[model samples]
Target: MRFGIPLLFGCVVAGSVMAVSCKRGEHVWTAPDTVNIPHNTSGELIRYGRELIVHTAMYLGPEGKVATISNGMNCQNCHLEAGTKFMGNNFAATAANYPRYRERSGSIESLDKRINDCLIRSLNGSPLDRNSHEMQAMIAYIEWVGMTVNNGAKPPGSGIRELPYLLRAADTSKGRLVFDNKCRECHGTDGTGKYDSLTKEYVYPPLWGPHSYNNGAGIFRLSKFAGYVKANMPLNNARLTDEEAWDVAAFVNSQPRTEKLFEKDWPDLNTKPPDVATAPFADTFSAVQHKYGPFGVIVKSRKKH
Candidate 1:
């Protein structure tokens, strides 16, 4: 089980650089803060940088499997720890080279489009809405990461990551009952999300155990889980009310999950998974992010729901 951000080494060379004003379409040189990285390999900071990269790799989520399968995977699965050199496919630099891409979406693509490509092609999932906050957040996060490491690196798809933990006091019994009543129909009485797994190939993975995020993934918080479920649950029957989503989350997460740590040649044991830091609410995502509160700025789209 390995999951983490991709790693980059050296520097990537894109189209010839031409200085331009701060205008959006210009190639203005934006220097990165290289203070933390050392000027020389023997330097202390360099060593730390290496260690940081290795450790940080552990935080990356799994890479996406082709969306045709219900594997319940993300890009972090394959490019484990940003291609920390273990089992990654090394596509970190692809970000800088895209927006000029020609893929299944047709025409050129931006970084977001590329990410969506992976979503549709590899994750067996639908593309996120173009202007969604989640989409934008993911875009920003990935771009920022791509700029790091200087060169192209990807993490391995070993399903290993420092998952944010589910709160111990989350009242799994309440969650369990809610799950049994509302979610069990699709997720299966066993909480394996087996319906999706059977309907799609590797598209919908079980929420716990070997197929899903390891203990390191710790995707136990309610908001992140609820958001995903609310936005896309019931196997193409999305459109869950916010409260319902929260209740469903309580139930689903209440189920049992393995505690053993996954070791699939992670870049570093010291570093945690990337999502752990960026997770909407981290360990206790439910209480903080949102539960039965105001769901302002919500959208009502007319899809297959």
Candidate 2:
């Protein structure tokens, strides 16, 4: 399948081909546009889902009508551009391969489970009732966006791509400079993010603070955060070197933010990522070492096992 640039009506004329690969193998497919939604119940549900994702805070924040389970951040904060843009934590493949096994929980999890995990961790709040209309609507939108994908397949560029680990732990001092130069303009020097007064939501969400993602959010993980920075930070243009990405991540994460929960996370110790914020891991490394760097050793050890 070939994808063209989407028009206002959701139709594409011609553009570059975006290749996607599933767990089975590489294939090409076009992402559907919200403009193409039919006038029907299913379309309404799908549209509702998109609204929930893009404006989650309005519906799920502390003052939300649907539920109060997020830190006033839209799902688009990390999922980026409504989960459509590639390498920006997009949801292009999420609906296709969920209800699959995840190392974090050490069980076969459903879409609702995955959504709740973000709610609890990234959103830094409680979980939505799995049967709730909000949850169902969000799922509907993800499924609609990914409906073209085959089940059990993980398309290439499905999620945030990883940047190579640094030779040593990231240097916060250097990272501070990088942040000042590249990120501080939008995220603010203090990392408190710029807000849209009219919407009462952040245009550039806080990177670290009470309102930011707690320590348990996936963004708290060094590699995940670094990769995301390398691929999508500064919006529109992403030109950070791998080292800059890592250093900036270290600098940002080293700052103060909300406390994290989840004592039972990564039930299978061996499956834990090297940069998990807390300790008591399958390895004999210290919590500080785990949270910081020289993660190549951890990666090598995991491979050996």
Candidate 3:
């Protein structure tokens, strides 16, 4: 899949998220405090990353083939605008925070599995195995982010999370209040998103539940999740404050959902469509969307400013 211009990927510095566009044919290497990635390289790998972003946008556009949103905008529409602002845990540091974590699968999981899950949810794409070239390249980009956070040191949570400027920091109490007001309606009091047995998936599976994460998974943190929730969550219908977004996630993730131990990084594994383990609302899920569904992109719905 091809991509477009450098749109997202910002390094969190001094509690501030700074946008970093990966240009084509560039391999920059700069000091810890400043971003000085090379800008004029004739390298294939670097340019590939740049192109992928653009191409991905085309597929996600209004007229593109397999467009996800009904509003008729490209993936680039949402991604280019506030992708950095809504980086959430999409950035690598969040992945670095996990290696083996408890998953809803009743087992410990890894970062790669989490990535697959995100692609399914956010990117609306198929999952890439742990060993796939695309997955590795994306990881490389994240590792670069991890390196930056550690001030050029290769450390876990080494990316934006470790930047010199501390973000707002995860605050649980405040977050709880946010969840109750905005999120509680759909996700339930437990933070578990609703489920549909017939659909064999969650309608609003809790972020932290029996179908959620625990010890072996990347532990839930606020900064990243907040960014994501603020912009792309609740089906991209949120207008939450940064502090509130972070706070609500803190409250939700604080709960114990599922903490057995499972592995999700199956380099050679191919996943089939989910077979619902025990979805109480399975039939309900199918009927709801099929009956009263709103198709296409709906956010910032207007095409022109």
Candidate 4:
């Protein structure tokens, strides 16, 4: 499955591979270019997969052409540039690593299952049919995106960066101020987001309310949301300090959104991350603390045990 592209050397930081380019000097990881894809059937599938990733709502949203399923938000709404942006929940390492065990689901998951997980949780929708062209195209695109990377390598910016845990619970009131000042222009004052009637999708995704990611979605975890917001937010003017990011994430997650029941998740409680917003934790931390932390203690307790 090699793409025959030369590997760029990069340094490791916090256990992930950072990019090495002549200009940046090992700072940024770049996704492979789409133009390099072959002019073949598989390439066609890969291209279609990218389309699915970019315009998932057009094909799969409530008013979708392919199937009426997902909430109006597109996959790119969370994935950012169809999962090519660094530290923006991109899929740069996904294809290379998956069919791997996930602590959240507590099992070895195929890429297909992973996509469906997003459909169910993040998109607040039902799973796409596995055999459908849309599904196959998405798989091809995601695999092709990561084909150049080594197997089992998590490139430095593959996913959301883990910000240092705050010493206190994230303050929703303070977060509200941050959102009103920095986030409201794009996402709207009510947090319902800007709607595109022509495209029938969100131009800027809702931070909360019924259409946003459900409780079971990864970003519902304050850490994940904060990291994502700090890396990319306010439509390119992302200057939120770490504290501001953490607070705003708390504020957003506190708002009403969709809910999902993950009765089978986290079968191994010990492997669960501290920010999981649910009950029956491996430790005795209150659910509120688990949701909005002061997580340094929880993390330390886990390491000690």
Candidate 5:
């Protein structure tokens, strides 16, 4: 998470010296402020995009106008700080690298496609119309953040920073204790997150329940959730060790949420991530192992084949 000087002044282009600022990092990307955007249509759209992410449930949940595709969770639940904060599943580099090939879908995907994937899986909801203003706004916001990032370059701290896998399976029994001590305060004893009455929204979103993310969500995958928990759980004060995060992630994911909405996800079975909850996999591992995992064995086997 090193930093480079943002401001630079130089060059005799048209006999003028111009000052420019650069965003640089290897493990952390600090997104630019929305305040810097001019008061124009593009800026308005970007602002709307940020709102859509932070308040996704209000716009696309059961009561939304555009569509009702997701469970009640907001997109910000996973992509923390409206996709700005590093190691919090930030979107600082999404715009630059997308419209690229993805093995999961086995096609070159656009930014809207990726967002729709989240809507379909992570939010346990349906996809947005690609041409819809809502979709366009979300894309605009992501593009604004990563406009300076070069294509194919995963800027520092662009995505979730996964922890090294443990030698043994993550223990949910241990996770229960960790949840009691570290997470219960905000996320609640039953793991149903707290609600803010005045705002009429969840303050601490549920980790599991009818309102939570579905089995197809990325967080349902142990490694992804574990890494996220390690870096951003406990509500702005992340203190879980890597192992503890893994265990807790297992515990939370094990609880019932929405069922998998679609079956035909990974077209290329070989490229499927080990933690995908879909069954009838290419491997002989048990479903329990796939869900909670001592996943290293599966990973190794895949490499050998």
Candidate 6:
């Protein structure tokens, strides 16, 4: 499953820039050309890093050649286009913004710490040794991807978009309908996703069940899931409305998945995001309210304090 080149979907080359079409009226961002990677040992590491991201499951999954760890899902499954796509959870600013405080850990985290967070939470896998070649390659690729971004600045479309909260709690029934109609073709009716045996990876990653992201993964949050869906779901034909996105997210997340308990997360309860989907809240909102929100009230209450 290793590839010499990184995956670049729906991109058009103009001069030296790669323009990827985005949501209507959104500014297009340029991804650095892989062609520019130097033909040296450093470039080899960078290329290996891209392969690690694009084929993470092959190298580091349950039956991985490197290690038997992650839940058989590639990092690109969520990061999208090896973390290059705009508003598609791209890594456009990650390199420049590390050693920053994250309320989740309540401490300043290095880039490797953040990568391990994704390994532990998103991939539901054990952390790669920070000193390992795999870890260094991943760091090299991510840093090279974001080298042009100014330090401490998140460029436009660096992460998931934020959709306004629905006036009502997101409806699973409605979400099921949206999933069946839009998502089932690739992800399957059971939401098990389509596995490509030849490639030894999922063509479409599962939305839920034992193999999907754990409860603590960022996409487990309805807002993040909905926003990600709105921007880049249903594969090539992303056209879900905000309401549809929110509902489908609720539907997908409601199904069973692995759970991760992190006692240290949100040490300051007040700093927790509104859609954590777990308990021990600083507010009086029910777990249901936190998970499937008519979250305007919860949000408003948080703002006043």
User: What TM-score would candidate 1 get against the native?
Assistant: 0.32
Q: In terms of TM-score, which candidate is stronger, 2 or 3?
A: 2
> Poorest 10 consecutive residues of model 1 by lDDT?
295-304
User: What is the C-alpha lDDT profile of model 1 across 1-305, one tens digit per residue?
Assistant: 12222223211113322111123222212223335333563344333433322322122223222113223554443333433321123334545565673422235568776655454433334566668644554554444434643333322211121112333323446556666666677556665644322322222245654444433332443545655554445543455555556666665554555443323323332232222222233123333223322222111111212
Between candidates 2 and 5, the TM-score winner: 2
TM-score preference between candidates 1 and 3, better one: 3
Model 6 bad stretches (over 4 Å): 1-27
Q: How does model 4 score by TM-score?
A: 0.91
lDDT for 222 in candidate 4 is: 93
CA displacement after TM-score superposition, residue 94 of candidate 4 (Å): 0.5
Cα deviation in Å at residue 37, candidate 3? 32
Candidate achieving higher lDDT, 1 or 3: 3
* Best of the two (2, 3) by lDDT: 2
lDDT of 4 by residue, 237-264 (tens): 6788999999999999999987777989
Clashing pairs in 6: none
